[model samples]
Target: MSLARTFVGFSSTDINYYRLMTAWKANTNIDFDFVDCQLQNSINSENEVYIKKLCRERIGMASKFIQLIGQDTRHKYKYVRWEAEVAIEKGCTIIGVNLNAARKMEQDTCPPILRDIGAIFIPFSPYIIKYAIENYSMGPEDWYYYGNEIYKGLGYE
Candidate 1:
């Protein structure tokens, strides 16, 4: 099968995780064309508008939207939220991966908008991610959630 065209939504703090996923794509057959929107410096109003337009354009081209839900993600109310909102509006298959879920005892800390919309949340496992990208249906009833554990059609125990 061909790789899914994926747009990754994340904050600067999660750049390492983004890099790791990129490396996974290189080293393994988890085929995906990862797209990112990272700005190095602050921009004025005109530049900001252009960047937002560019981000929306790129996000609109994606088949899947993967959000790296770190603790600070919710606080990044500009780009991350805008990207996710655009993805949701464009009918992209949205998936939230909690970066701290593996070590943290609390529930997955996704953005409030995502959690409110009931977007599927999965662990940061490459196997599960690939499976989700390939198999997760874009229907409300297709997701499997057991209390704090959200399964994206991977049949996890």
Candidate 2:
């Protein structure tokens, strides 16, 4: 089977984790072709219009969006937030992965928009990641909202 097209949204400080994920993908059976949306080159002189256009286009092509939450992630909103907003608008399945070392004690520390939209937050586990990617439904109504909490329709606990 072909791998799912995934877009990874993260802070620049977490670049090493992204690199590790890439290496893991290369060495393991993770079934997703990851696209690193974090800008590496200097965009100092580039036009904002062009940058946004390029990012939106790349995110548009992805079927799944993974936001790696780190300590600095909640404070860095420029690229990560923009990428996630575009992904949500494009109907990509959003999965928030809490870095093992940076896991926050409060759920409210999660990106506000992601939490408001009821995105599933999971620990950094390869099996859970694969399961989330494979089982996430694309329809809007597939998400479950109960009382004050949003539960993933796939019965994640």
Model number with the top lDDT: 1
Cα lDDT tens digits, model 2, 21-68, are 777667656643444544445466558788788788778888889888
Q: For model 1, what is the alpha-carbon lDDT of residue 143?
A: 39
**TM-scores, all models, native as reference:** 0.75, 0.73
**Residue 155 C-alpha lDDT in model 2:** 39
Model 2: lDDT equals 0.67
Per-residue accuracy of model 1 over 56-148 as CA lDDT, tens digit each: 877877888888888888888778898999988988887888786542222446666676454566677676677667766565633332343
lDDT of each: 0.70, 0.67
TM-score of 2: 0.73
How far does residue 84 in candidate 1 sit from its true spot (Å)? 0.4
